[model samples]
Target: MCGIVGAVARRDIVPVLVEGLKRLEYRGYDSAGVAVLNGDIKRVRRVGRVAEMEAGVRAENLQGEIGIGHTRWATHGGVTEPNAHPHVSQGLIAVVHNGIIENHEEKRQYLRQLGYQFDSQTDTEVIAHLVHHYYLQNGDLFLAVQQVASELTGAYAIAVMAKDQPGVLACARMGCPLVVGLGEGEQFIASDISAILSVTRRFQFLEDGDVAEVRHDKIHIVDRNRQPVERKLHVSDLSLTSLELGSYSHFMQKEIHEQPKALADTIEPILEEGFSPALFGAAAAEVLPKVEGVLILACGTSYYAGMVARHWIESIAKLPCQIEIASEYRYSETFAKPNWLVVTISQSGETLDTMEALKFAFSLGHDKSLSICNVRESALPRASNLVFYTRAGAEIGVASTKAFTTQLVALFALAATLAKLKGQLSVDQEKQHLDALRLIPGSVQHALNLEPQIKLWAERFYSKHHALFLGRVLHYPIALEGALKLKEISYIHAEAYPAGELKHGPLALVDQDMPIVVIAPNDALLEKLKSNMQEVRARGGELFVFTDLDSHFTESEGVNVIRTPRHAGVLSPIVHAIPVQLLAYHTALQRGTDVDKPRNLAKSVTVE
Candidate 1:
């Protein structure tokens, strides 16, 4: 994923564009650039972070009332300055874009035949050339952009500014996100809300095929057919504090600690008096009871959240649940039955694989779609028939912490709501689950208090080249998440398996140097998990156990135990996610790796 920010203001917009790029830097950071339309089209780009690009712009003294800026994630070419955004066309048009242009090679060849020369190996470069070609034909920037949108094949959110058109900009969106920010005497456009939040809170989200004409004092929006369209402008609810780390060392650590408030916010509606399935939606009471099964599509940490929900839905609601990696689900021949509910989970809610997977499921006769997401206005939530918004706020870290836990809270609530709708949960059982849900925030605080002792475990992990994570039943996904966190940030080679499967294959990798982390929650499988721990000990593998206070386990030679304040029954996964996140954060700190932005990985995977 890349970030795009543009503004048409009465004053010099270079500083505003640079500041907006800084807020959007978490989207991508490999390269950044900007285009300013003053007397002539001035372009400045660099092969590093946005800060480098800002420095270059200041050194060059580029000034304009209208400008567009971008921070790239390097999809089509190497992270070179020439491959950065704001690609210029014939000294007239400048373009900044997000998302892929699938047929760019064909278009590039055609443009080359028309005697257009190319400079960079980016799919986005063709956009500027194509728009310039159309502008030469019609002499209208808005019409030129509309014509070019018809020829582009893949996902794109593009902003085009012309040197001749001094105070004007045109933007179009197909599959990626673009929004128009309304101000008193200025107009702004960005790929994310955080970029333009300071400039304007009132914004209109452009739809799939909408084109927007933006100038210094006004913005006009229209659909593909050239008919004017009206869109509602909503005020944004995000504050700048959500984007800043108050006193934490890294964003991952801050997000891990933010889970309590996030969880409480997510479950607040369900905890209120007269809770019902209608709380989710008006049609939820009707649709949920008739649903036959559930098909969940997600990627990365979101997929693991689905895995945890599978246990809850099957045990509580008695529903057959299946989880699919969103990337693979579209290509697979898996058919969905009619009336089968489709659930999608994402932190950004704009993940392309998950969005495509949702479309594929709908194409196969599945009508019901629900999105569990943190973003209220992202594509995934908008495409779904029902939406459950998670108030996790903005997670800036590449490694997910608060978003994943809040997703679990949402999914668990969905399971409980479905159970109540299906008549599977009695009133007392419902009350018990609600009571446990209410305790999660305080229980998470208790788990976070184990940070000092967990630091000792982090010391053990510093030298571990390889690690094995083991869990049983409801906790296996937590084990997988733990391993994922360690590898994502610490660069450690980690693998997770069900505890019973250790003797089958993973046990052979056990040795004195390897630390075997076990998610030994005091549940029905606690004794069985303990026996598996003994197997690791017999093979000379060091044991790190995360358990509750009343557990019978004790620390011994080669084994270390960390206990929380209480044992969580049905809500154990939400509670257990904390220590593993902390473990990963501290381990990454010990390894001297970047905890916020891991190398070669972007926070949002917008491209395939």
Candidate 2:
């Protein structure tokens, strides 16, 4: 994942590009670089955070109205100044890339044979050469990118600038997100909203095959086939306040408290007046009547949301749903029936892997494909047959909080909606879950209130490097999310294993130095969790648990238990997740990570 920002502005673009890059720093921080077309072509790159890299650059000499910049996480290359983005080739052109180039070796060899020398190990280097090669052949920057992009395979979102034309920037996307923002006498382009949010709110979401040519005073669009297309102007709703830390020490803490509002915002539209799933009556009739099984695809925290939804989907909808990581689903070459429903979940809606996986499923003729995403204008939602919008409202933290819970809410709601269409759910069953959902905001509020206690616990264990989380069934996903939160922010080597998998191998890693956080709510698996606790205790593991008040966690000498509300089995995980998430957030804060913008992470994984 990386953050990319670029501009073709009428005014001095260096300051605008710099400001935009600063806002996007949360997305990726391993290294940062910028390329601008001044009087003489200028490019600066370094293997460090933005602040470190920027401090050493010649701010006065870096003059340009057209430029591109990137903060990288090093998916395809080692972290070095050469590996840093804004890769330059043939003297004038520079390109910054986000996603993986699955077929880079062949392209690299092809370029080498054609007498192009590369300085970096990045799959991105091929692009600079390709663009340079195309320009040399065609003498047109726009046609160069379009031609080079056509020959390119695998996912990429690239922004290129040429010294031959200092007032324009050319960008393209294939299986990645690129947006064109329209400002007065200026046009902006970036991987997502944050980069251009500082510049303009007016944007057009670039489609998969579209190539955008952003100039200082105009923006042009073209189809993959080179047909001219009209620019669709859209006003983004992102406000300045959404970009601020807003008195909170960390974005996770801010988002944790925003859950009540986020959950309420998501459900309010459905709860308004006499709302019904019949709003999707047409889709319900067409899809649920034929859907045989479900293929749920997602990545990271959204993947965890999908995992939790499988239980509800199987229990309530009675569908055999298989949750697959998006990166795996696309290339697995499975024998899915034509009537199999495919659902992709993403918080940003621009998750590169998930979008590609959904597109692959669609290409394979899946009868129905749907998306649940926070961003309404995102590519995944637009391409899917049905879209469920999650109004989580701008999650800025690199590690998700409200976005994860809201995705769970959206997926569970979508499952119920499907079940209602299939006539599998009784009226009472539907009403009960609906009632429980309505009360969830209050439950979430209560969970957020327990942050003080979680902070105290975090202070005690923040210094540890190795931590593990364990849970069974539904809470298994929660355990994974907890581990992700810790690892993403604290840089802690943490893993989440299924509670039953203790003896399989991970048991060997447990010791006094390892802090094991167990999600043991008062469910049917309480006995199983109790047995697992003994297993950890047997191995001299130090346990820090978020268990229900009614849990059978006795006064054990070597373990510590933090009590939570003894809620229902179905609602328990959602309630129980808050404290552990809080624990991770505070632990990272105490450990002095840039909690909102951790090292080598970004708010949106637009590249891959």
Candidate 3:
């Protein structure tokens, strides 16, 4: 994933562009660059953080009224200055692109036949050359980008500025997200709204195939077929304060602490008004009774959330459930039951794999679709038949925390709603579930109270190279999530397995050096989980158990017990998630890794 920010404005936009790239730093990038049109394209690039690029800009006194900036997560190229974005061609055209061009090799060979020289080993460099080739023939930046876009294949969002066409910026999107910001006597474009939130909030989200020519005062838009169209303008409600680090050392730590508020914001309204199928969407009332089963599709952390939802939906709603990785689901054949609800979960809702998978399911005749997302204006919600917005606000960390907890809260609410609709849950049962949901914030807060102890555990974990996590039944997905968190931030190799599967294969990897984390809730499977822990202890494996207070687990030789709050039955997953998140955060802190933006990871996966 990469970040793009462009502006056609009256003021010198170098500072703005650099600041925009700085805001997008959390998206994970190996290099930063900016190109400005001042009679000719003046470009500066660096193979490190945005600060390095900003310093280079300052040293060179680079200033221009119109410019484009990029923070690149390397793909199809090495982390070098030549491979950084805002790639220019012949000192005439400059382009910054996000996403990949699948047919770049063919395009490159064709362009080489035309005597166009290549510079960097990036798919984006071809776009700049292609745009230059078209601009030389047409002498119109907008039409040139349009013509070049028609020749390209695969997903991309690109912003182009030509030296011959000053004060104008051309941008296009196909299968990747781009937003146009409306400002006074200025215009802005970015892959994410947060990149330019300090400048403006009013934006127009470009559809799958959209081309726009942006000027200081006006913006012209056209569809894939070249017909002019209008997109609705939305005013984002995200405040600048929410994006700040406040007192927290890192965004991951801040987000881990924000889980309680995030959960309350997601489910409190539903709890007060009581559950209704209409809470999901206006059509849910008609669609819920017709739903025979559920197919959940997601990726990364969201996929694990779906895994947990499968258990809830099957046990509570009395519905058959299936979970699939969105990336794999799109490429494989699936038998779509017409009555089965296609549920997609994502934090940003712009995950390309999940979005494409949702379309694939729809093409297979699965009509009903629901999206659980945080961003209200994202593409997934617009494409879904029903929507549930998780109010976790902006999760800037590459490794998700509050977003994951809020999703579990939303999914649990959905399960209860489905159960009530199917007559599987009685009135008293629904009330009890609602009460338990209300107490989730408090339970999460109780879990947060164990952070100091978890931080101590982190001290032991930071130096460990390998970790194994074990859980059973409802908590198995939490174990997977915990392992993912540790692997993501702390850069430690971690693997999770069902406790029952430890003997089958994973137990061989266990030793005194292997730190084994076990999630022991006070459920019926607690005894079985204890037996699994004993198996680990017998193998000279160190045990780190996150258990409920009543689980009757205590610390001894090579054993460490961190007690969570009393189990809140159905909502235990949300509570248990907090300690693992803190553990990852503090461990990454001890290891001195970038906890917010881990290496080779992006906050949102907008490309395949």
Q: How high a TM-score does candidate 1 get? A: 0.98
Q: Where is the poorest 10-residue window by lDDT in model 3?
A: 268-277
Candidate 3 stretches greater than 4 Å from native: none
TM-score of each: 0.98, 0.92, 0.99
Model 1 off-target regions past 4 Å?
A: 273-275
* Global local distance difference test of model 3: 0.91
Error of 1 at 410 (Å): 1.1
User: What lDDT is obtained when candidate 1 is compared to the true structure?
Assistant: 0.90
Q: 542 in model 2: Cα distance from truth in Å? A: 3.4
Between prediction 1 and prediction 3, which has the larger lDDT? 3
Go through the candidates in order and give the C-alpha RMSD of each one to the true structure. Answer: 1.3, 2.6, 1.0
Which lDDT tens digits does candidate 3 get at residues 454-549?
A: 989999999999999998888899999999999999999999999999999999999999999999999989988889899999999999999998
Clash count per candidate:
0, 3, 0
Q: Count backbone clashes in candidate 2.
A: 3
The deviation in Å at residue 91 for candidate 3 is 0.9
The CA lDDT at 1 in model 3 is 81
Candidate lDDT values, in order: 0.90, 0.81, 0.91
